[model samples]
Target: MTATISGWSAIVSPRYLGATVTLCLGVALLAFNGFLVSTALPTAVAELGGVALLSWATTVFLVFAIMGGAGAALLKERLGARMALIAAASVFLLGSLIAAIAGSMPELLVGRALQGLGEGIVAAICYALIPELFPSSLVPKVFGAESVVWALAAFGGPVLSGGLTETLSWRAAFAVNLPIGAIFIALVLLIVPRGIRSKAEGRLPIVRLLLIGAAIMAVSVGGLLDSPVLTGLCLALAAATLWSVIVRDRTAATPLFPTHAFRLDDVVGAGLWVILLMPLAQAGSAVFLVYALQNIFAFGPTLAGMVGAVMAITWSIVAILVAGVSDATRPRLIRIGPMLLVAGLGLLAVALAMGQLPLVILSQVLIGASYGASWAYTSQTIMEAARPGERDRASALLPTIQSAGYGIGAAVAGLIANSAGIAAASTPEALTGVLVMTFALCAGLSLPAVWAALAMTRR
Candidate 1:
């Protein structure tokens, strides 16, 4: 009999329960880890002495994560789902141990990169497992379960992580990942089959991967530079490298992105721009939101983490509400989302200037809700808009592009803050001024993103 997605009961039924929990665990591991790290990293930096390298915390993880996600399919093909999952979990566990024991900023970053690589693959594999393990009718339920996981992580992850950091230490926060990863591996052994491996087509795109990595590194290094002229040169080099990679990939037998990947005139291209810019715009907030709250509001770690989570919490709730909207309304949402982001960032900038807490809260809600209201419709539209031949590649590339956007955005925001003298700022007012620049940059990105959203919807 086909599994029915009639109610929550079916998902929780004994027959489906273990598999459901496993899949959801994979997602939860990734989401919860991200929130935990975000909330705890500031403290980690304080202990480790990498004040200037703060943004690299996010930049390095995201860069490595994009690479991991892109390579997941091939990994699965070689190792089988069972082994692949165990390997991923083991790597994540190892990373947690390294991070937990780290005595320096560089050590923490290495651990973070390993964690990103492992978790990225785990999440991707979980997505692949969904279709195989559940009937078509139940796929929605599986995804719905994941949304709840994300929501819970957003709502409570920061507070829990912050509490752990406060009571124990920043290292304690990382140690939480150890047991979770072990359980994940155990579940994989119990539930996943050994014969799941298969021959895969195409070698990994080593050259393209290198180009992407180099570009991100350039952007990140540029952000750390003291000289504005040198920063501009680094940005230019990064851009040129990215463009060259895309151009080269268009003709690759195993192209990383479609031929029309970033073409503004094409639907997938415009939609891809929105994917890239949306996260890129939000990255500053991701990297700096908690820190800003701590500085300006004098909030405790727990409180600052909760405030930082408002955006994600709002986004998750709103996304669920908008999941089943009509096609007619989705197009409107595509435009509305970016516009809301613009408004959110603008309000945040002003709120910081005026030291208005309520306004700051409102801005976070608007920005998080913006993504919930629009991201799904935006993604569906982009997938549907792609030419038949390029459709699959375009769709697969969306998440990866979004990851790249965040990495690049963090680099840009870090650069802006460093250039604005955040390192030298001794008071909350000075820090606020520097953070405002990042918010303003996000607001500025809205123009092109909204334009692209409009363009994509028309297709």
Candidate 2:
């Protein structure tokens, strides 16, 4: 049965207030930081002079973040939730400081890597901490609140970063992280308790971790290099490494994932596939849309940011609304969710082809709503599907899968864009065609996600 709490009142009730604040701020910091950096990167590169290395600024953060997420459960077990958060915030602060003062591209990348690592740790811990901190009924509410915070980030981060970049300096965006991290740390020390440990104290899966990390890095690096041959090789390497991890884990005494995590017939496996494919499709569309808006439509950074905000806004709204839905209804929502995504992408393809700004924005809203409705349930399903001892790992897997999916998806999208002549397009018409192809490609990719979601309903 779902928790009895109704409406938004449950989140602010005395029993859950402190946990609610801490969780929201912890997650908000990560989301805000991501959008802030994306907004600031262009100005940062212009000032620092590493135009060619632009992608690395984002890639390094994601790769290490995935690594940190992979180890979050172990970190929490050894350090406790309070201390784990403290450590994460501290590292994040240090990274922000480094980026703030960086004089070169290399220095900025180092700072970004730290930021990613700390953010990864924080993201993993936040998801894992939810079950421990909140009642079963409120878990969905908490995740819904996370979507709200992310929406806030989407709305606020770009505008704020753009203002700072234009008026003061790009470095100011990085500087803002200092105060946010400090506040998160203070909240942790005050509201959260100490000495919470994991049920499974098994040793870290070093080999599997390395393999996954390599796969993420390979695909990310593949995105940066424009060579068709090199991209193909890197993707192949990434695929091989991932297969090895699955094969290796199948026989291990302590497997990284539960057995059902790899089986399509099981809810856990189906949920993971949904997690993987959704981000893959969304990120790909996002990359293409942002490029098309700015380059082809001549939209300013702030306007483009507002356009991007449509997704988060709808997502947040739907997440909250879906929280009140009954358990029996969620399965149907999950099955229908990807179809909505497919439909949204189809609209996006038309919008890009016609260069209609209103339609593009509407498509984003629909896509976001579809994602929000399903994500609330998919997240809850993953946690509930875990065996007793595997909850932490299950929680950690959600973000890990998400990060890996984005990295791979973005890389693959870049390849598709390049193949479609986006980089060499000489006119607006050529750019429009490229975007149409790209969105169409992304839409096609979501078909398998629909299959995955439907598989969850199987016996």
Candidate 3:
């Protein structure tokens, strides 16, 4: 262990316990909202009688979140972290209220969109604030603690969603956020000291931000549209809009993302690679597993959900353990993490081919552990590499790559399954074949991440 790690390990004493809890609660609220929505979304769609639009709810939030995260970085530069957090919390509260009271699907979506904006800003600020608040030696440990909160949120999110939907209503799930958001905002103001205000870099263009947000919303909502051709066109427009943003950023005096991020430094590039590959490997396998378990094994929704939770629980546990270790050895852990992921995915492919459920579940456990450790390591690595002031800009790209990778992976898997004579509805043989192909692709994509990890040490 390095001196830095040893110091951080010692800093988690009784005196700073209050500050630590406050920080964890604030970050956990953001993640709880994210996970809760995913759990309750199915029920929401069923009630609204628009099952086709189910995916839109998740996609739209992510799209808007990208824009919000970028904007928050800029806002933090102007208003300072403390004030920026206040603004984000307010927006989140209002959005939660809107979601809870919404009468129609469109209205509910509007609320969700607003919530996404708040989520994006708050998430970026959280990453940006960690380095500023904690000593350099303790930053990684703080981030690791945050990851534990995220894991808890991920584990608890679905269970809460299921319980809320079954007992009360889906509306209750959104309503729950109001009180939590309020409490967190209060705690942040009371606990965190106000620092020097951030020096502004002129003003951000509101019109440009709107254009980006609109383009993302169109892509997500379009996907929900029944017309296949229209959906394709919308996706094309989204792509063009993103490309324009990239071009503009290259030339702009103050870009939304830092210039070097796109240039791909060893740590940043490794972070991006993990962001892309982990999601692809995890999500693709997940969709396939859900199908195989429910169709092949004839499991109920409750049972299937429990099986899914196993992966998340194991991932969280591994992340916490690895994060607590010393920084000098962290780099090696990063390398091993991705390699294990690739190996786990490969094993899953073989298990699928052999028609063995036990083997498949075991593969999931390994993959989950790899994912947990990789996520924590990558997050810490990116924070370590970024310039002090540009942390938010760099961190914003991580989520964007993750969301994009998962979407692309799921779509590609769907196409492959359909083309291979598997109908949309699941069957034992068809699902088994889909799992085989999906795992194979995930294993292959993970190879590049391994290479990226190797490159990190050399740099």
Candidate 4:
């Protein structure tokens, strides 16, 4: 099969089109859930009476997502991608239903956990399938197109969430996933062709997998708990479990994460840096921005939602522009992306300090642009670095790391905000301090990416 094709031709190809659309729909659903919940969550917690467990709503999903993603190769090896995807979609749908009707905080968390599992599996498989479905030359364009789907989901989700909450109930936010999930499942069944299944797997280490999952869950849920003692203990246990897993995986015939994935070489190093820091800079700041607008600027839910939408739009535009130029000079684009991110976050921080809501909104445009360029370049760089056969595993690992990073960043930020008493303070001073901290974190994260990009360009 040819590895290179023109962008226009790739888009029109029947196989490529089918796979892209199916993957886009699946990813869009995931993005929509993430975006909608961010807007609706404050209200959800108020109604559910579990402000303590608030962060769990996001962190739990991320923890399971990493575990599910890590286990995806094992599952796909045992059950084929087609079956794996179907199972994931079904579980996601079930989770959505549970969350939609959850009577208590625990039930809602349970639903979120299930959804996270499904999301992880689906995301890993979708990424793994990309190289198989498209030629090498077409991968960038196809992946770039997928970014558009994510952007749309991000842009529309907040608006929809705000409107739905105003017109109906916050539970209705989850209800939106039902139809999307059903359609994604249907399309995958009808369009995705059966391919050669993986044959190189021993029995899955159920105990180790469970340990890893529990460790991730502990850290995620622990971060949300009000008790610092419990959170610290859970984090310690999580660290221990991770250390044990690393040791065991080294000796195991088959491991959850590929052994070579951790290599600190140029391409792999750059890819991992992007994976870890993108969320730290992007999603982490997003949490702060949303709260800052609501609490400090006195923006209603609808206006805050609109600000987020603008960010998403800018992200899409930058992604497309970067994709168009990627073939000619990927390393250069990668280098510049991080600098843009740093500048954006700097502007955002200054705006918050000055109590300028309008300026803050403009800063989001900068953030969005940086996110777009960096995300596309990072993904392509990772794909390029992997061995041909290992692409699936590499792709699967990307999202797992991304989700894990987001969870860690948010959890850490939450701890800081909570400890400083910023989360509860109704005053603008507290809000500004929190926003400043978030921006500082984002800016700090971007600096490393800048160095990574420069290193890549030098090569």
Number of the predicted model whose lDDT against the real structure is largest: 2
Task: Give the RMSD in angstroms, all C-alphas superposed, for model 3.
Answer: 3.3
RMSD of each: 4.0, 2.2, 3.3, 3.4
User: Model 2, 1-459: lDDT tens per residue?
Assistant: 123365567778887888899988888877999889998998999989989888888888988888888778778777887899899889989999999999999999999999988989888888887888886677878989999899988888888998999999999999999988898899899887886665665677887877777899999989877786788789999999888888888787657665677578888888889989988887777777776788879988667767877888999888888887877888888887888899898899999888788999899988998888898788778788888777877787788888888888888888888888877898989988887888889889888999998887664
Could you give me the TM-score of model 4 versus the true structure?
Answer: 0.87
lDDT of 4 at 18: 81
Better of 3 and 4 by lDDT: 4
36-100 per-residue lDDT for model 3 (tens digits): 88888777887776676667777767767767876777777777777888898788788888888
**Model 1: residue 15 alpha-carbon error in angstroms:** 7.7
lDDT for residue 354 in candidate 2, whole number 0-100: 83
Angstrom error of the Cα, residue 340, model 3: value is 1.7
What tens-digit string does per-residue lDDT give for candidate 1 at 373-410? 88866666665666754544555565677777877777
The residue-by-residue lDDT of candidate 4 on 1-459, one tens digit each, is: 332355546665775678878878877877889988877888888888888788778877877788888888777766787888999989998999999998888999999999989988998888777767766666667667777877777767778998998899889998888898999988889876666677775787877878878887876776676665676777778779877886788678776665455444557655666676667666656667776788888888768767867777888777776665646677767777778888888888889889887788788888788777767667767776776565666777777777766766665665555655674666789778876876776677678767766655554
- Go through the candidates in order and give each one's C-alpha lDDT: 0.79, 0.85, 0.71, 0.76
* Weakest 10 consecutive residues of candidate 1 by summed lDDT: 1-10
Residue pairs clashing in model 2 are 3-137
After TM-score superposition, the amount by which residue 85's alpha carbon in candidate 1 deviates from its true location, in angstroms, is: 3.7
